[model samples]
Target: MESGERTLITLFEEIVNRFPHRVAITAGDQELRYRELDRRANAVARRLRESGTTDEAPVALFLPRGAELAVGLLGVLKAGAAYVPLDPDHPGDRITWTLKDTGASHVVTVPGYADLFAGSGVLPVLVGMDAEAEAPSLRGGPPGAEDLAYVIHTSGSTGLPKGVEIEHRHVVRLFDVTHPWFGFDEHDVWALFHSIAFDFSVWEFWGALLFGGRLVIMPKPVARSPRALHELLRVQGVTVLNQTASAFARLAAADDGAERPLTALRVVVFGGERLDVGRLRGWIARHGDAHPRLVNMYGITEATVHASHRPITAADLDAPGVSPIGFPLPDLVFHVLDEDGRPVAEGVAGELYLSGAGVARGYLGRTELTKERFVELADPTGGACRAYRTGDRVLALPDGDHVYLGRTDDQVKIRGYRVEPGEVEAVLLRAPEVSAAVVLAHSYGEDDVRLIAHVVSDEDPSVLAPRLGQLAAGLLPEHMRPSAYLVRTGLPLTPNGKVDKARMPAPTAETISAPVAEPDGTSAELTDTERRIALIWQAVLEVPRVGRDTDFFDLGGTSLSLLRMFQQVNSEFGTGLDITVLIEAASVAELAQRVEAARAVSPSAP
Candidate 1:
């Protein structure tokens, strides 16, 4: 085989041959050298084959991040079967979904996690990697480059997760593309910070297994704290580090610097979330010259792991704004397309679409969805060619770099106007003392769409309100500016670590500090009825801001919340308005008017 044209299995073989004595993985106090990992994987694979499993069979691995997870995955590959990684910490429903989705008949897990799928009808025959399992005879098996290696399920924020089936060729292509960035060698010790279930872990494993680099898996507790993580890196003599943006942000936010000396570190990579430019600069400054090379990688689960990475420099730190995600890595092709599927002009915002070797073979078991998103492109060659329609909105810069905008679905139509939540968030984050910002839309029955901004800051919203209005005027259209601004101490986060915008509080009039009246009286003012209704809205939505024009749903008030509001209004006013009336006139002002009308027409009253 040519030097660069090696599949994942072949790559692992090379590592066992050339660097057998080098340490490959570390879990707790246990260590597995490259030779040990290879030998054990071969033994496990031989056992699996003896059990009647073949190269195409699905083997499920429900282990946490550790040596066993690594060996188990490679063993499945060696047995000519695809491995499905299931995070033990994930909810049981999610795990069950994966099991049924993949039809996995065998599972490799420790004794403690064996019963997690007790009732699962397909009940994977549990295989133990402990000392008790027989160490079977090792045998070599050849798998073609196009054979499936693994299936990675995406974080199901929108719906049930779909598995992206990645082949060995995709893995080989990625290693070839990113090898030079980290300068992987037998001597390098790469810390595994991501969950084995995450696609990034696939990169970490392959980077080490192929290049002969040592993989050091940190304990679960240490992975949670920056100080503990820092100490582990230094103590373990880790040379390469990789973490998601949120993890890096916590590390950068910590006061302790020397806790993890960066002297031995050669490279630091961040992915899985949007990187905050200011936070990145702060991290670079704290580590100083001893800091390793910083890389911002961009990818989706549909793309094996990472499709592109750009090395950060001091000049990049000094420049304005967050850095562009940079160009695609070698063998990958990035295209920016307009709504009509035509190529977008330079510097124009468009939907980002990915093509080339990094793209996966489509969602496993979801033919309709797979065909919808992954379409055959116009490739001159007669062979198979595909492109993924990433719904991400981005602007293609003149330098061939791309600037990320918010998701296309997040765009809202407010007051007969179009609005992008990211534009609002950008303005809020740029505000003084604001550390983070999230914008969520609330909707009521009417055409009203209200924008609520959740900002993390100690600054008083009263003082921040007018200034924000001023800042927003220049940057946003009237409709896009949030009707209500809320200063939250912090935002919520989902399990996968991305910001939980869906859980953000609705914006109400209460959160905003009343602006001082201008002498010219140009500011919008509320009438007594408006004020009373706003108060009612604040009580109902549990938000501080409630403009008369704001939609009840737009205030984060759901139908359930509206129902409660109706009960409260009925109790306070002694009005006998039916629940149907409240549901019909969903807007606060409209519902208030209905209350007044009902009072005026009540029979046998007065």
Candidate 2:
């Protein structure tokens, strides 16, 4: 293939030919060299092709984080098909919805995750990685650059996940244009620290493989535990890391009093959420910005992971509380436009419209949404060009940089996931008793944000609230699930008869506490340990009070918030506790029990 005409498949094949002996991926104790990875993925491609999974076919990968995940992603592309990654960790309903929407004819999964497709309708042809590839070589050569590479699903404002159609060239040019800024090479080791369903993982995996680097697939347990993840980075010699700002905050705090610091990381790029520069003060004091340079990138999935980038240093800590996304890539341009689509003056806040090589091919099977979000405008050359309208409100700087303000709509980002409050509200409104529902996002800390749902119902709060909570848990993922569900007799409305979101009451102890009562209408008071734990939860969650039995997730606690809460609990109690403990023990009473159990075995136990 000509160098200028290379797609992801061709580019990756070139890398494989050049570095066949180099280790390409590491997951757990298993490692796959470029030669082995190529042979394996090629076999998968052959099998897919033999099974009639041809060009532009949407093959869904419903697998866990493993070498198989990479194999599936590459294999689909090698078969001239676009891969659709489905997070196994998400709610089953959501997974089913994605499968049906994408109309995937094949699924790349393992035996352990085979059950994920149980409720996904009649099921696609289940192609396991373990299946020996006895088929012939793929007939067609690699797909063209304009061919669809992947279809990533993003939460939609209309209560569904919209599949974004990204072409091979769009993603290839992302790194190609930014190569000068970051000289990634084979020597670097990167961590696949995000869910494959998330776009950040696209940057993580491709960034490593395209440059002949080693990519480590972080196990779910290790990914959730800050202590374990830090140790993994140190032991695995990870050099390039990608994280959401909130996740990095917990990681920095975990590194605070460590006997050994992570010195291998050379580039820590923060994306997925608006970075809070203030969170990096202590890390700067410890590591400085020389070795592992910090970068804050502003982007959305539609813009192919990142559009703008700025270095974050101690110098930024001195500036105002602003998130500065330095500038767009050389090939990408931004239009800070008013509601009427007119260009706004520099330094004036407006919705960010990104256009250029980074813009994807628009939403799959969503012509109306695609037209609404991705609009056409006159380019400098006088021809029409397409741009993706990011709902983010940004102030365009004279230097072509952008300072992120906030979102223009009700959508809010929680732990790097773009969540549409209306999606959650739509789920809540499914309950028969719910007359009206609104989901709101609130920040309990600088980086810790959570979702709160307010529902209008005539039913008793105690009986109806828990049902809504259970319903959301069954239908929504942990990040999208509301941390708290408040019951209201009636909703506040505006002059236009719309729910006056501005008038929605800020979450407080009494307002949030109205949702629950004992099944017998009698509750136990907080014990000393439970009270201490409650106090810590109250402080970390920024709530007035946390009862002994209050469910952590029901209180609007997210994985990031749980991490922050545990960091404090572990410090105060001098116990090594994993954040995953919340999975089984979420309430203050349950966590206190585990805390006491850990203390019993500790030398500090009295």
Candidate 3:
């Protein structure tokens, strides 16, 4: 298929015509063949056209991750409208903000979420309501190659999120340029493991459907549990897998005792965060570099999804510390420029600027921001071309690879999610008690990072901590929420009166209150299982002592730490428990009850 010849919908139509009877998507027990998917999407497009959707206005997809999501995406494109992805897991206010900001005409969602847009003034089209409707006669028309395909909202330095308007040609160019090098075919089974709101989903979803490959819609719980993910990879015969560096580390660590773990996986693409090549040593030792080639792609939302790719090998792991982000894609050009916007010499660290077909149009409704970040550069060939200024500090190696230094701004990536500290700080300041606020990311482990909030308030630390946490929970997503909340009388300041982040003290266990004594004034005795769990929590959380009633998260345990805790429990007890169990039982005492119940039902119970 030619890159500029058609939009994604037309390209997908061509594939559907060729492979109608083939299974296109699978989620749990539901499977949709290519023909059926096309017909269903056409029906949805008919309904959307009736609702007055157009190429200029985008439709909001507020559905869960399932076959319906795939249908919604294709259906919106078939209707000649860009689709705005909305994650149901985001806070209600965030969703409402996005819905209003985008000014979408309609939202495609199940009945359960219809109430979320109740007062938002947008129409909701339930998935099953018009299942028997006729397919749209105008399918795959109106939208041109340069038309907007989707508007993905990303974190902003300002309090609100900014929508990135990406065109069909950019997406087409992405697959067009990378497909030949990656060699993705119909035989490959791709996993849609990321939230649709995240840019990574763009590559995962389209890379499969556009290539005539079977796409597996991973359930949310399965995506979170490494063991479950490992089993799914084997059972579903997933050939091409994509994961963030942190998530891949968990998956690799979960394969401790398996002889041939992830052997079915042929290609594993790592993106959304820095690829710490050292973390892959265990997986490489077990499976070797021959199968499931590891490719690290450094990218940003503004630049479509990916900009460069580097195939990591065991030899690359032996390097001291630096992991180089490989060369840019054929259609894209990257330049390392100094503060003056002049290109820097090779090996000099500077801000990276990207110019290419994959570069997005600009931030929606943010004209000044778009102008500042996306600027026109004088091309050596004579005409001026636009480039996106990536606030990343990178040094271009002599061999053409780029070594990632760090960020030039306050943006920090937590678990592969881009977080602007100012955004979190803005949310923190919304609380009435907060006089001043600062949010920062701190290293929880070698490969794990967590956010922490430092606030200045007259209120007592014990009194204000929980309120701030509650506010954050109601406002921010899980990744953006601060793992630890520290209250200070006043924030440390530099000589220039700016908040001195370097002088901020790290949060300690002392911030957490000790577990209360038992009802009868005596300490609660721990059972054998409880004792084991306590020990594991202590080791994972780095706490000196853990009481039976101690909350894991309250003791500074995060999602990564919870995974390690579960791994330890599974190893010690020989019991397979899902990570959600920890979420359900936030305290050791409650978790002990769950463990006892599972043990009683176990076939090997003594």
Candidate 4:
């Protein structure tokens, strides 16, 4: 609680005063200590104040995931304005979208991306050694308890993204609660795995600064690569390994090449998804001598990073699936309630609501949505305490903990049966041949939600598709099986490194020929040539199905995918459909006729 007086500004003051000369951040061969970061941040902060940017204004940060981003973020906070992080690796459209939405007055970016925002009217402040050392123009007022610290925008599955406004008090509370749990000390060296845009990076940033520990920011390539991450762990002397479940799974799945003994790993914190305990045990079993502590954290962006966590051991893995997220932080309260707003019995799945100081103020400029998701506790302890309905389905376990069920909205009804798409996708990903999978409700007049598998292996979808369906049948319910299987060299990924479902291809009627031949098959019969062309449509648009009259772009097909499709047709069928044909003849029937006409041309018809 003493840290309450020490806001973002105070935290930096403490570091500059106490550990000025201590090494603060290290990226590549470059090293910066506390005193340098403090001085640079002050200069940037002062420059910001002179520009009339105050506490309420948001400054956009488009620096890479390294020291520049760290400095810029701290500087923006020092200027008493919230910082909006846009990953430099993201597409220009994504960055432009966030910038325009946030209404950021100034953008701090490298010289490379300067031209990307040319017409945005945002003042570009280039980050370099000079900007870092410039003296702060004037000291800004300190941030208040409820003052906005930062705004993190989450990709909305349904529509445009919404920014979650986090306050200083929320950050303070998270640090206070998690500090005691981790028992971090000045000697700790934690690996920073997440991008600056995500809220979890706050944990890696403040967690280190608050405890005077070392923060080793992994290079983007190293962070994404399992082998590189494993190597960094051994080389960097990372005592605390924090990553998402996806990252953990990859690390745990890696083969035993030259075992990089993770002897220094005191704690491994995993979150962002349901971790497979089987893989956890298997990973530990192979590296038994390492004896690292495994901690599972459960939290939301609405809450300042993490609110609950539990440590796991080899013995705990033997009991069942992944363990329940333990009780809330000491200063927080987590309740499990049923639909009628009554407390549920242990082992009964209910909506998990969180009440704590760590809950964020609300969504930025979205009071309606904020009030909808975060409501007053049905069982109130009086006074202004409000509980955030996490929209997460969880249960009170017999062991006095909470088990995380998938999201309530996450489950979709397919053919009148409820199916968790994530559950099916998890099974699909488990197949060594499959690199990624996504299941969505594909409407074909029957409201049949089809499962789509995007495999990276060289195996043919015709042979592998049936085998995968068989595998799913054995492991999942009949309704959970993917109606159609599609294989690709790679799955489309958004700039944020998540599966870009919107970019997935459309399913053409012809590609479903195999199942259609079986009579009970949902697909209609189409010939071999038609089937081959239909596959091109599915691979390009990422849609569930293409009707005879369905348009291509209307189904989320893009010009880039169309170009690739034209090339595929040329290589495989000795016919290249005019790129303009996609626009002129949007429907499959029209496109098929056009393709037939194209085939009539000779190779010499340039």
Please, what are the lDDT tens digits per residue for candidate 3 over residues 177-234? 8987789888889999999999999999999999899999999877866667778888
Q: What C-alpha lDDT, on a 0 to 100 scale, does residue 497 get in candidate 3? A: 97
lDDT: worst 10-residue window of model 1:
514-523
lDDT of 1 by residue, 423-460 (tens): 57876667767888777777543223467666788887
Each prediction's whole-model lDDT (CA): 0.69, 0.82, 0.81, 0.68
For candidate 2, what is the lDDT? 0.82
Report the number of clashing residue pairs per model: 16, 2, 0, 10
In candidate 2, what are the lDDT values of residues 1-606, reduced to their tens digit?
564587998889889999999999999998989977887788878877888887998999887788888887888899999999988877777877887898887887776777756755433444444436434348477798899999999888888889999999889999988788889999989999999989999899999999999999999867765667888999999999999987787677567645678888999999998876877888898899877999888888998999887988888888647889888888888878899988887568998888998798989999999999999987778898899888889987776767899988988888899999888899999999998899998776566577788898888876787677678767777688776678888888899899888888668655784433322334578878788888888777766556677666556565557767878888888888766554447678888999899998896843
Clashing residue pairs in candidate 3 (N, C-alpha, C atoms within 3 angstroms): none
lDDT of 4 by residue, 274-393 (tens): 554655666677765235778888878888888888877676667655546777888788888888767888778998888878888887877788898788875455565588887778
lDDT of predicted model 4: 0.68
Pitting candidate 1 against candidate 2, the one with the higher TM-score is: 2
